[model samples]
Target chain A: MSENIAERVKKIIVEHLGVEADKVQDNANFIDDLGADSLDTVELVMAFEEEFGCSIPDDAAEKIRTVKDVIDYIQKQV
Target chain B: MRRVVVTGIGVLSPLGYGHKANWEALVKGQSGLSKIRSFDPTDYVSQVAGHVPVGREIGQFNPDEILSPKEQRHVDPFILYGMAAGQQAVQDLNWLPETEEEKNRFGVYFGSGVGGLMGIINSGKSVETVGPRRLTPFAIPSILINLIGGHLSIKYGLQGPNIACATACATGSHAIGEAARLIRDDRADIMLAGSSEAAICPVGIAGFSQMRALSNHFNETPQKASRPWDKERDGFVMAEGAGAVVLEEYEHAKKRGAKIYGELVGYGLTADAYHFTAPGGTGAKRAILQALKEADITPDQVDYINAHGTSTPMGDLVEFKAVKEIFDGTNVAMSSTKSMTGHMLGAAGSAEAVYTLLAMQNNVLPPTINLDNPEEETAGFNLVPHKAQEKQVTYALSNSFGFGGTNATLLFKKVLNET
Candidate 1:
């Protein structure tokens, strides 16, 4: 289930940002490494919540800046 | 006053995509109206629309050519149509402002009659079904009427005046007319002006259908739906498209050896202040007279008129009465290209303006198709019925009147010789 969550999070990021799957590594920051604005990051968070069937609060969404952050958050929540 | 001339034009209509294709199909008396395929219209009262054909044909529109997948997801179709037409015009003119000074003198003025109704509806449904937090971040910009101009200004790096007119069906005419004013006033050396519309969605059709403003009689025979001035006419057919023109100061265009289509000599706008949806003959007549007066020409000197004939019963006769009152005993031939392109709402005015220029250049007037049984009141005016006509057009007028009784007229004079 943890591995599935990581794959799903990466898929959502790649699809939302139109970024390369290879570039979406665990340590890759959404805004720094991937080309995503503030709004795009928020949208990606919403997409993750919908995919994992969990609610991501606003404060928590702001802390989710990297691919690993999203994977870790989802693994703990869902 | 600095004189203004049309340097380039672009059009994306149900008739065709580019201006050339649209002109060719138009003069051939082709009807672009068909059964609405963008959405299932089984529940809609008016099931026909003039949607831009999607394909790889010379004049057909391909969405992939205009926007990337992610960019497309961020905008509504109106913005895409506007950008497509605007890019065509910019490319046709080959005038890219490179220096900061030049960029500051370039601007974009585009509009839509009803902007992004589909986007709004879809966004609302998403928020309703899911939650408000699930809404896309681009929803607000996607539904903005002025985003067309905003997007164009950003893409082209235009730093001058960027604005939009939202006068319902008259949006295109108002945009072009006001943009010409900007050039004439020396605020901008060159301006891209036009209007786009993509409001043939379910709610748009339903709203107009509720007002009995759309034709529902000929859904099975879609081509015969928008019969302007004909006795069998019902209501206007909804359409989606965009039309844009590049307006430059006469001396500036001449200095650059630009190919001038024609000179925009007169622009007039007036309010009816009488009815919301119906035309007050007085205001339309005043607008026509105002344009002719500003052009310093009599009604007899005008050769052609592209009328705001939307195929509605009351609107057609009212506009005709106004034309007759103004052009009485004159040989000014008039035709409604809406008979072919359908009612493109905000795009109608600029598209008709482009058609008027083509008519003057080629000396061939587009026809008002489906006018087999012309109404008795339309007897005096040369309605250019059923087929295109070849006649040397000197001065032509394109008229657009919107729902709020806003009327605008643009007068164009053919340039016989290069100065």
Candidate 2:
């Protein structure tokens, strides 16, 4: 189930940011490594919430800075 | 107060792309109307429209040549057409603003009559048939009306007042007039002022046809659909397109060695305060007189007028009566290019304004083609019917009266030859 969450998180990141799928590694930082600005990060979180059927708070979204972090948050919420 | 001068022009009409193509088509008195190709039009009564050509004809629009795959998804065709004209105007001026101050001094006042009516209609139908979850995120941004100014300003990094006017068919004229005021009021040194429209869609066709505002009898001969001032005229032919101009301060443009097209000498805006759909004779006449007054010129000084003759039974006569009442004794050669290119709604005023400048430059008045038999009211004015005429035009005017009795008149002075 965690593996499925990781894959889904990577998919959302790729689709939302137009990034290559393989580059969305688990530990890659959204801003430093994935080339996301503040606006992009907010949109990515919204896409995650819509796709995963989860509601992320502002502080919770701020804590999610990588693909692995997004997966962990979604799993905890579900 | 800064005097506004037109240094560049961009056009995307049913006739073709850019100022040269549209001017050439206008001078040749060619019509761009045909059986509706954007949609089936099988269900609509008025099946004829002046759609912008997209195929490999001599002067057709090729979307692939303009926008990228990703950029195309973020905006509607209204934005695309407006951007194309804005890009052309920028390129024509060869303007490269490298400083933040230069960017801040440049602005865009572009507008449209409707807010992506076709895009909204298409998506609304899709949502009903396919559900809300199927809608794309870009749908909302793409449907917003003011995105033309937003998109064009972002593309060129113009940081001044980005305004959007939505005064029905008078949107373009109001945009130009307002932008010129912005320059005159020392708010901006330059402005990209105009409008765009691509409403040749299912709803646009049905809505206009239901109101009996579009030409229908000439479906078999679509080229003759928009016969303005002619007795055979039934209604306006709906056309889809855009037009733009780079308006700059006169001394600033002169300093930059910009080739001035014309001078925006005056602008007049008024309201009917009488009717919603029907035009008010008093308001329209007052608009014309006000424009001439602001220009500090008498009615006789004007040589040509590109009329907002939509070819409708009431509108055509109403505009003629107004112009006649104002410039009755003046030898002003008036014509409506709408006879050939159809009425382009929000883009109509700017498009005709561009054509008016072209006429002043070419020194040849464009013919109001398909004017087989001019009505008695149209007989007094030199309606330049069925054939082009060479008139040493130095000053010209363009009128745009729209729904809700919104009236606007823009007067331009020839400025290229003086230097």
Candidate 3:
């Protein structure tokens, strides 16, 4: 289940950034590796909210730095 | 100073398709407001508008009437309306100057407040449903403001300075003023100038509703809701339409034997910088004074004033005070065409300009419908109410102010001695 959640999160990141899904791994930083701008990051967070059926407040959204952080946040919320 | 004259006119108003129908309807005092049928507005606050009644059913209009099909699909509805109006204007003048050089000497300047809200809304829905990846490739091109001018330039093969202005509601007047300046500066011999708007969608309605800028009192009585200068006036009824005019140098138009409607004498633009969405009365007064000054005409010389009266409670009052200040004590014939057509946003300036021009041509000022009892806020002005007025309109001024505290006023003089 953990592996599947990570895969789904990676797919979302790659799709949002228009990057290769294989390149968006757990350690990949959204800004540094995926070339995502501030708006892209915010939109990514929104996508996460809709996909997981949970709310990510701005304070918590600020702490989400990498694909791994998003996965962990989703896991905790779920 | 170089003189600019309107050689041709075209419109796609709610009253009808062409200029004749629109002019007749205006003269006869016909209201275009109806129940919101384009979309379900039951959940929304503003439930009525001057929507294009047959837009969808008209589907994929013959671009040969304007341009080829391949070129038509790339632009937004505002641009489509602009192009169609521009085509009509060009055709009416038989303005196909024989060589490519003449084509290069003409340009297009158009405006739109919200470029392609329908396109944005449709693409946004796709993003919400099938995810962002399913977004169409034409999304960005269809929503940009400048593409209206770009498509017009391409369609007419115009190579001169083609530009688009987005001054919210003052956009059309700004476009016309800027295009006339180009003629004054000897940049272009002729300019296909006007504005278009197609923001009558779900998101468009919802955004305006959220701002409390639309009428919510009349779901059952849509026509009566847009009551300018009336005691019961609540708010403006949003409308969608476009108007275009062919502005050419007076000598050039005469040489071509084009029918000259009137000479565009002066244009004035001012910014209140006071509020984001509301008008400051003093700022509008300055705009009107500047226009009259630029036209080198006295206040009493003006015969008719086409008001920017959006029928909003505050907007109508501010404009009334502005007109009062400009005319000082003289009672100029003033009427808000928006009372009948509803507010057409960026296109309001040009639409009102067309009405002003027609009024000047026929010597009849169209009525400001729905003004039952003039409010105390709107005092000491001759607001032409209920019925059209016939008068020798030598000089007419049109005012349009927008959301960003932008204001534009245009002056037109009837051509008395043409021979």
Candidate 4:
């Protein structure tokens, strides 16, 4: 389940930001490394919530900045 | 005052993709209108439209060449079409500002009759079904009328005056005329000016159909639906496209050895001040004569006219009567490319202006198709019906009238070597 979550997070980031799949590493920051603006970050959170069947509030959403952060959050919820 | 001349033109019209393709199709009297294919129109009153074909063919428009699939997902079709046409015009002009001063001296003036109507309508549906939280972050920028100019300015590093006029059908003409005024005032040396529109959506069709402003009589024979000045004409057919031109200061263009299509010597803008939807008074007449006055020429000096003939009963006849009143004795030939390209709304004026320049360049007037029985008022008028005519078109004029009684006229004089 953990490996599946990691693959899913990378896929979403690659599709949303139109970046290379290899660049969406667990430690790579969405803003600093992946080139996402504030709006794109917000949209990425929404996509994650829909995919995982869970809601990430605004306060929690602000903390999600990397592929690892999304995997950890979704793992805890599911 | 600096004079302005048209150096490059680009078009993405129902007739074709490039200006040359559109001009060839127009001269051959081909109809771009057909049963709506973008969406199912069986439920709507007016089911015909002139939509841009999508492919990699000779005249088809392929948006992938301009934007990636992900990038295009954020922007509306109107902006995409405008960007494509603007890029084509800039490339045609072969000028990209590399220096700070050159960038500062470049500008953009683009407009649209209705910007991103489909975007707004889809967002409204999302709000009702999935709520606003699911809406995309690029919603606001995608729907703004001025974003076309904004995107073009950013792409070319143009840092001069940037504006987008939203004067309905006259938006294109007003954008070009106002950009010329900027050059004439020495504000900018070069400007990309024109308009784009893609509002042939469900709500757009319903709105115009409710107002009885579309042709429903020939949905079965879609090509014949947009017959401007014809006795069987009912209303105009909506179209989606863009037309862009590179307008440069005459001296600047000449110094760069740029090809000048024609010189835009005069333009006139006026309002009827009478009704919201219907045209009134001598506004059309006054606008044309005012343009002639500014051109410093008499009525007989004019050769060809691209009329604001939108196939509607009242609009076509009123424009015809005005032309008759002004060019009664002159052997001026008039034609409505709308009879082929349909009514592109905001893009109509700019596309017709490009067509007028082509007419002067090729000395051939595009014809108004499907004029089987002309209106009685058009007895003595040379409406250039059914077939293209070859004539020495030295001076040409294009007219555009819009809702809220706005009118704009642009006069183009062929560039003779002596001048």
Candidate 5:
């Protein structure tokens, strides 16, 4: 289930940001490492909430910065 | 005063993809109108349009051909057609300023009748069904009316003025005329100007249908739906496409040995202020006179006119009256390419300008196909019905009128001293 969550997060980032899938590494930052803007980060959180069938609030969404952050958030909610 | 000349043209029309292809189709009386296939139009009253041909019969339009897949996903279809046509115009001219200084002299002026109707309609549906969070981030940029100019400017690195006109049906013609003024006023040496439209989507059909502006009688025979100057004509058929031309200053074209298709000599614009949807011969007459006066020629000097003639019952009658009043019963030939291409809205004017230019080049007047019965008002004029007429066209005028009572007339004179 955790592996599935990581794969889903990576897929969303790749499709939404139009970045290469391989570049969405665990330590890769959302803005610094993946070229995501403030709006893109917000939308990425929404995508995670929709995909994982969970509601992420503002403070929790703010805490995510990298691919691993999104993967870990989804795993914790699941 | 710098003179404006048409050096190159690019057409992505419902009839075909390129200039020569559209010309051949028009001259041959081929109808690009048929049943709508972009969506299921079974519930709509007006079920036909001049849709750009695609699918297996005609090759699909790969947007990636002009824009990268990521970029293509964000823009509207009108921008796609506009970019393709704009690229073709630049390529046909073989003119891309190599240096940054030269690029600064090039500009773009493009418009659309209804921008991104499909995008708006789809996004509206998604909001109702799937909720607002599902909306794409690119929706705003995709649906803006002026993004055709934005997309083309980005693609060509054009550094001069970027203009976008949304004068409804007259949008394309106004874009061309206004862009010529930019060159004439020394603002830009070269301007890529025209219009593109992809408004045959569900909302476009529904909205126009509500206005009673679309044909309803010919759903069974879509080809005969747009019968300009015929008594049986009901209304105009919606269409989708783009048309573009590279307008360069005469000296610049001559210096570069660019092939000049025709010289744009006069432009006239006016407003009716009468009704939102209705047009009057009074405004059209004044606009026609303004153009002729600027060209410094009488109506007798004109050999042909590409009439707007959208085949609407009221519009055709008033426009024919306007033509008769402008020419005062002269024998100059006039016809509507809309008889074949339907009403392309914003793209209609530029596409018809291309046809008129081609007619001047070849001296072959395209027929107003399906004009089997001339309305009594059209009896004296040579509607050039059912067959292409070969004539020595020295000067020609193209008329485009749109909603909001806007009207534009462009005059082009053939080069007589070319040796």
Candidate 6:
């Protein structure tokens, strides 16, 4: 279940950043690998919030750095 | 300075689609106001407008008509309206320049206040639902105010200076005056000039409703809503249309055997800077005086004044005061055509100019309808209320004042001699 959730989150990141799914792995950083600016990152978080039906606060949004971080946050919130 | 004369005129107003029909309707004192059928205004405070009814077929985008189908789809309705009127002006006068120099020396000058409001509203909806990526590439070009001039230049193959002046409601007057200046300064032999507007959209209605700048008293009786100078007047009823006129140099037009209507004698422009939206009334007086001085005519020499009474309480009162100050108790025939056509915004100036010329040509002044009881402040002047009056008008002045405190006054005189 955990692996499945991580795969789903990674797919979303890859689609949002226009990158390959494999490149947006658990260990890869969003800025370094996925190539997202500050606004893009914020928008990505908003899309995730809407898609997952989860509320991500500003502080929690700041903590999300990678696809794995988003998966973890969604897991904890849901 | 060179002299300029009106050679041709065309219009698509609330009364009808052509000048003759509109003139007939005006002479019959018919009202064009009706309930808002273009959009459902059940929730809107102001629920009426003078809309050009749908299903009236303006000829297709043939090369002879105006523009191509592709180009027509990308432009706003105002531009389409302008093109229709421009094409009619060209056809009515059979203005076929045989030489390249004649074509090049002809230019276009048009104006619009709120261009492509319908386009903006559609784009706004698309952006909200499908995101900004769904916005069409032609959205900005279609909505820009100057596209009226661009479309005219392209359609007619005019190569001279193409310009557009967007000064809110005064746009039409400014455009006509500027085109005349081009002729007066010997810049162009012929100039296509006018203004158009299509601001009767959801956002436009909502914005004007929020500002309380539109009439709300006659949601049920829309025809009686736009009552200018009446004690019961509330606010102006929004209107949409276009008006165009072809101005040519006196000797040049006569040499080409063009039928001239009247001579454009003077144009005066001024700014109130008193308030953002309201006129100072004094500044309008100055503009009128400046136009009189430029025309070298006294107040009594002016026989008719087409007043820009928008039916708004403040606007009507301020225009009355301004006219009084300009005329100084002299008997001058004045009438607010907004009472019949509603407020055409940027198109009002040009539409009123056409009416003024028609009055000069026919020796009749159209009445200000819907005025059952004149307001206290509006009683002094000869408002020409209720019924059309017959008068021998030699010289006429038309005034148009818009938001941002901008004002323009134009003087026209009946052509007496070829020189």
Give the 10-residue window scoring lowest on summed lDDT in candidate 3 chain B: B54-63
lDDT (C-alpha) at residue B181 in model 3: 96
* Candidate 4 chain A, run of 10 with poorest lDDT: A37-46
Give per-candidate clash totals. 0, 0, 0, 0, 0, 0
List candidate 5 stretches off by more than 4 Å. A13-46, A55-69, A72-77, B55-60, B416-419
How well is each residue in B176-263 modelled by candidate 2, as lDDT tens digits?
9999999999999999999989898888888888888989889889998898888898999999898888899999998888898899
Q: Estimate, for each residue in B125-199, the C-alpha lDDT of model 4 and write its tens digit.
A: 877898888887787888899999999998889999999999999998999999999999889999999999999
- What DockQ was computed for model 6? 0.02
Task: Mark the regions of model 2 whose C-alpha exceeds 4 Å error after superposition.
Answer: A1-78, B55-58, B416-419
Worst 10 residues of 2 chain B by lDDT: B65-74
> Which residue ranges in model 3 land beyond 4 Å of their true spot?
A1-78, B55-73, B377-380
Best by TM-score: 4
lDDT of 5 by residue, A8-74 (tens): 8899999888899889899999999888877677777878888889988889888988888878877
Per-residue lDDT of candidate 6, residues B1-419 (tens digit) = 78899998988778767778777777777788899888889999999898864443541122224554545656788888888777777777677666789788999999998888899888888799977643565678788878888877876788887999898889889999999999888889999999998899888888887888899999999989998899888888999888889999988888878787799998889999899886774778888888899989999989999889989988888888888876867879888888888999999898888888988888888889998899887666788988889999999999999999999998999996655
Better of 4 and 6 by TM-score: 4
Give, for candidate 6 chain B, the lowest lDDT window spanning 10 residues.
Answer: B55-64
lDDT of 3 by residue, B85-108 (tens): 677677766776557778878988
Clashing pairs in 4: none
For every prediction, compared with the true complex, DockQ reads 0.83, 0.15, 0.02, 0.69, 0.30, 0.02
List per-model TM-scores for chain B: 0.99, 0.97, 0.95, 0.99, 0.97, 0.95
Classify candidate 5 by CAPRI docking class: acceptable
Worst 10 residues of 1 chain B by lDDT: B278-287
Give the whole-model CA lDDT for all candidates, comma-separated: 0.92, 0.86, 0.84, 0.92, 0.88, 0.83
RMSD of model 2, in Å?
3.4
Cα RMSD for candidates in order:
1.5, 3.4, 10.1, 1.4, 2.6, 10.6
Candidate 6: where is the Cα deviation over 4 Å?
A1-78, B56-70, B417-419
Q: Regarding lDDT, does 1 or 3 come out ahead?
A: 1
In model 2, what lDDT does residue A17 have? 71
